[model samples]
Target: MKMCRTAAIAAICMCGSVFAQEQDRKFEVYGFADLNITKYWMEDNAAFRGLRYDDKLRVDLSHVNTYFDFRPNGNTRAMVELSFQGDPVANRSTAGTTVYTVSQGGAVNTVIGTLPLPAAGETKVSETQGTTLEGNSKIRALEGIVYDWGSFSIERAWMEVQFNDKANLLAGKFITPAGVWNVDHGSPVILTVKQPFQTGLVSIFPKSQIGIMERGRGYIGDVDLDYSAYLSTGRIHNTDETRNSLLIETPKDLAVGGNLSVNFPVASGLKIGASGFSGMQKQEYRQRIVKVDITKPATDAANEAAGLVATGKLDPTGIASYIQTKVGEYVATQALNPDNHSYDDVMKAQARENVFGVDAVLDVKKFSLQTEFNQQRIKNQLKNDSLTKTTGFYGLASYKIPMGENARLTPYVMYERVMQEGADNNAGTFMSGSNTGTPGSVLEGFQTYVGGVNLRLFTNFIIKAEYSYADVLTQGIYKDHETVFDAGALNIQFSMAF
Candidate 1:
């Protein structure tokens, strides 16, 4: 009887331990998805047509995201988000080519042949006469389409430690604490189907960073104040004509930035904020051979010298001198070709940038107003390069109307502008070549007007329809000549969170 009573007590203790553990840990899962259909129209300009989205109706399975939140205890929390995004209308194809070289008795012969097209995600390689040729394929849209295949990415993963209501610490990959639009990044939460030109077209600031941040909030005389400071890996210097992933590149220096905001209780949801970042952006331009041509000047020179010697027109001692001169000329010609160089010929471009912005938001009952202004100054560290300046501003207003129970309608309009000066407007300075101006030249700026309406059927579901018109100032051949192009787009989106 005594042993039975001991077993019962132990069983009770085990149950208590299990309950305590459950109370100490917590987990939750949620996600959001969006679908978009868009129609675009632009002036028929050959220079800009290929670079911009085609003028057609396009449907996209825009974003499918899943989020996980966990709390091991009251003071610490973790969050992770996974996103799958791209257009379903996109497709890809691959083609291959092979080049053969044959050298016999100092006479070289070349032949070009076509190989069977490989399937997607496959590479074809052929080797003949001690020469190797490889055919590589990439993912791209079908002919006349400007869409790409779907991609899976980890959007955010971060952990936070709370020390009190006044102070907290967060670290990992997190979104930048910038203007109002960037923070409300989710499609379900954003009021409009289209984002501001600053955030969408030319990103003055990064979307997120891997680093550490310190944030806190406090009350000051019935006014709420929040502030954050962070240090991150920032941007890397990649001049390979292709963008490099931040996860793979090693940063030369760290970036520092901060945000501060104040909310006034008297104004009823009025908030003002300032955010800025300063960092050095660096890039190294490396020359690489994209193709090998066996019939270069050097080969021609060698062949000529051999023929002269066989014909007894050139002496053995004079042949070296003649060949040396020819080789020097060949070197100069190769240098003119940007691709025929080694790592020792790399060029570097480094610049320091300081970006600052101010944002304001006013919410009164069912009416809301938001505006932001951002400016960036880039000072080139290289000699003979001038300072470049870019500025962007946007203002948005919206009014919400009741549409029966569990439904609401919000109509909104926005105007945004982006301008750049003190440098040539090219692909390197702007997000895209076609959107800015002609290469190695300057143009005015771009301005956009947007109008949209949102229908919220439930707290977690929304439908949006939007129209936008944009004008770009492009430069002509003459210094004083400029032209403007009008472009427009219509977008419809459905978003849901669960």
Candidate 2:
């Protein structure tokens, strides 16, 4: 009887110990919180176009992320990370039309030369407003609002399960695997204060995809191959839910893509990868319309032709007929008038929006270098004949100077350039939300230079400051279409992760 009691007690003690160990493995909590401040020194009235730092400086909570981890064992784990950041869309607008210069050099209210004006009650579409005035003006309006600065939102919420050291599966909203900047996009961790424009605006990087991800890694002949494949609800299609092209609503469609990378075992510092995604981001394209009188010109030209025929300056059978034809041709050539001067929402098929990119990351000792080149093809609905291709690239280099054992200062410099081929000149929309109707509002491309430093006060606290210069390239609508404009700013941030 004593032996039985002793054995029972021992078994109960073992079970209790196992339960305690399991409890310890079931829960883990971690996250990061950060503060950021941005100041604009873009000289008075500098045309930043779509970047929102028009003429002010602002400060807000940059990131507050919390992570809850559930691990049942070494081989199985799940995670949930929530981002609490400021609202990215406090500046959005559903009203007010974005107006653009119809004249060359973005000139307003002044006609340059003998630009003809349509007569009274006639609506004309000109480089200038078609009013019977000195300046003929043309205007195009898009239906949407720009993203406002400063608001709070849930940045990421996803669950990940690891099958083993070499394989894993992730479900829910997750970071895109397009580039290094996106994969390691915490403000406290990156070398710089701001992301590259190309990565943020054009590439599949910097956008969250709601989907499932499968990741695997293995060694091949002294080299390592790491890959991630994902299927997600594609990009948001409604402009009303878009803030700077980032969809703010739940996705309802399928977007499939993946990333494959190779890391060398020779050195722990180098990795090269490529990623691509194809999906429909279709939205209703609202074509700009202006009312114009279509009947008067045809009538006046016919009357003139009849008079010419009667005067015999043109023979009714020969020269008169030719004159009438020429008159009709002239009117048709200048016909800016449409049968219906009302606006129409043509459901434009951004039927196929695809992005492909290659990226390389080098972390050799204390020095790190990152670069990526991407090409995005978006089919143009308005100009159905062509597919708009946007190409962009960025290179960033940084060096870390360790201060004692717990702190370090890392200085970095980066350059980025973007070119949009065959984009609408009047689509003065930008991801940065700066110039509403000015320079970049209708910009084509730009070159940017950014330099910054990150100072770690301790293992958990970091201070970062950066200065950036932007050389804006105007679109075809401006006389200085290819000309370069200047914009510059300073950014400072403080952050902690634990």
Candidate 3:
């Protein structure tokens, strides 16, 4: 009897241990898949349209995202999100094909051959002599379209150690802490098919980073405040034009930034915030084989300076001019010498970049409105040695439809404008050999209009269709180019989450 009782006790203890283990551990798995198909239309004489008048469709697996969340206890949690995302970098014509190189003064479009991929010892060039591609039907993949599974990438992996109700520490590769889009980038959550240029092209902040962040929330007399700050691996790597990659590697230097915000009890669901960052980024510029004669002056002023130095009494301005002349000659000799040059040479430099922004969101009942404005500056990419300060903003408004039950719809519209100094208009023109008035010949920026409707079927599925119109701002002789005109595009998407 004693032996039987001991055996029973052992079994009960084991069962209790198993029960406790089950109580302490929890795991949840969920995911979403999103796809987008886009079509474009443009005028016959428009300077350059990405897919003008072509019935061909552009299909993208925008995101196939999977998430795993684990909780060992009340104070600890971990999450990981893997995404199979379509490659945006592959949106260019194939190497060795003809493509438009530039648009002149807004009126003239220049076309050129895509330079062949260089061999082991040869140099690769971006432009040559050729005709523009006829249509946008070819899809890039390892094989044909049958094998073009998009990149399986780790989009987010992070762990959180919660100390209390108001504080937590998180670390790992994560979405950026600032910006509304950065926080709500999932397909089921975002309302638009395309990301705004203000948050993407014009913002100096990176989309994601490997870092550590301190986040917390507090209340003051019923008003609430939320804050986050992070130190992350900086932007260092360059896009390997030779081969595309899903993840950038070998981050150098450091990037530090943070966000602070307050929620007001003055109104329901109203919040305002500001964010800022400063860092040094490694910039890569195209390598060109510039032919320079040391005897020839790069600027007429340089020649005058040299002559003044050879003549008479030196003033501070003259001395400075003389130094500039000598430096110019030295740089030309070092950079333009044919024997030391390669078309594949990427000139790398560390440029200081600064960004600041403010945002507000108002959510009331079925109506939601949000807007953000950002200004960013980067060193030494534009003319006259001045910082290229880009200014941009976007305003979005959405209204949820009043459906009875199990069905929901939301209609939304957004307007965005982003202006960058000396950026390409991408209108499908080659601006070649046309530097008449300005030191650089590229166009300035773009403005866009977007409208869409989102439909939710039951709880797990979402359907979206959107239309956009874009206009390019051009300068110089190609400015009036008939082809450099406005463009309209349509995008449709379906998404599911569980």
For each candidate in the order shown, give its overall lDDT on alpha carbons.
Answer: 0.64, 0.61, 0.60
Q: State model 3's lDDT.
A: 0.60
In candidate 1, which residue ranges exceed 4 Å CA deviation?
A: 1-25, 46-50, 87-149, 236-252, 285-348, 383-385, 425-428, 431-439, 475-484
Name the candidate, 1 or 2, with the larger lDDT value. 1
Order the candidate numbers by TM-score, best to worst.
Answer: 1, 2, 3
- lDDT for each residue of candidate 1 in 1-498, tens digit (9 for 90 to 100): 868844743443343221244444477667777889988887566223544566779898788777777888888989988777763222233434333333344222333333344456432222222112112111111111133467676677999999998888999988888878777778988898877867654667666777889999999888999999998776432222222323324444577898999998744499999999876665443333222222212454564555424443444334333333333343335533555433322224456677899999999989999999988777666634456787899999999999999899999999999888765422235632321132444455678899999999987789999999876665443334222255788999999876
TM-score of each: 0.70, 0.65, 0.65
Candidate 2 TM-score, true structure as reference: 0.65
Q: How good is model 3 by TM-score?
A: 0.65
Candidate 2 at 137: error in angstroms?
A: 26
Q: After aligning candidate 3 to the native by TM-score, how far in Å is the CA of 281 from where it should be?
A: 1.3
Residue 12: error of model 1 in Å? 37
Indicate which candidate wins on TM-score.
Answer: 1
Q: List, residue by residue over 8-35, the lDDT tens digit for candidate 2.
A: 4345334322124433557656666677
**Per-model RMSD to reference:** 12.7, 14.9, 15.7
